[model samples]
Target: MSIVERMKNLSEKECPVDILRKEIAGSKCSDCGKCVFGYEGVTQLQMMLGDITEKKGKGTDLALMKELCALMKTQSLCEDGEDVADAVSYALAHHAQEFEAHVAKKGCAAGVCKKFMTYHILAENCTGCGDCLDACEEDAIAGKKRFIHVIDQKECIQCGACMDACDEDAIVRAGAVKPRCPKKPVPCKRK
Candidate 1:
């Protein structure tokens, strides 16, 4: 039930004859004794699909890739048709986890996804800034009079509201901040 084997079987029994002929013209025909309908290599098929997608204006969309991967996870098909979809589905579903462990190795599940931000309280720097206290949706920041501003990591969402509220530049990001969906790092682990 490997995709390669299943693809050949499907191609032989269900694929269009014209498609098979085109594959042959591409000199990608499989001469396997058992192959009834020639099948181009899987990599070629991937490339061809890319070309077709571009022509159709369905260019690579990461969200689409994720949907396809997730669908494939529960999909019944085991061949190329099925595998490609599954790959996309899974990638989209867990793109965040995959991204975090990537070059950044950070997680923003608590709304604290960036490294440039962290939970902290400015002692002398803070003039008992109530702006942050008023901005805090979680009441994590607590102080009165001259008490320093403190951040409760256990509750702070890392929304950077405190950072924006702090006129004294007391708030900061914990580590390297990145987009919610990064495209520069590349998805595959090659780079």
Candidate 2:
């Protein structure tokens, strides 16, 4: 579907900022340097959108993006640039609050952006088998043979490797609100 269609029909699990970032990142608009608006404008949009998804958005990014998109709509040499500009404009007009939340470092409401998510090992579900620890390239998981594993938020890259390697589904991704897991490894509550 087009970016505008996807934006209008966003599911609760979909994040508008992240979605737009992906669309722009994957589009061919930046491949054409025939026009300054088509190339430079879309390139800037790609960078800004990327920063927003990565939680590095500046306070002035929204305004700058609006201005660039407006210029791209009228000055672009091809329909591709105009289409992308329209999609971005529509997203900014309708989902500005979501962009604001990302810029403010609040959190991704849809939990789609990995940067805004935290990994947690549910105390009730952890088997303490150390599979998660083995999967963690960052050594973010701490646990022993029979103790509940705890995730070190500072070290975790939020890669979801622990979640995937967990046979018991102990690891979970949390957004905005974190689960009440122990800060360090603790005795397993499960048998």
**Candidate 1 residue runs with Cα over 4 Å from true position:** 1-117, 176-191
Best by TM-score: 2
Candidate 2 segments exceeding 4 Å error: none
TM-scores for every candidate against the unseen true structure: 0.37, 0.91
lDDT of 1 by residue, 48-131 (tens): 333322222133433444443444345423344344343333333433353233223233233322332465653535666468
lDDT of 2 by residue, 71-170 (tens): 9899998888888899999999999889999999999888889999999999999978999999999988788999999988899988889899999988
Error of 2 at 63 (Å): 1.2
Give me the candidate number with maximum lDDT. Answer: 2
> Model 1, residue 41: displacement in angstroms?
24
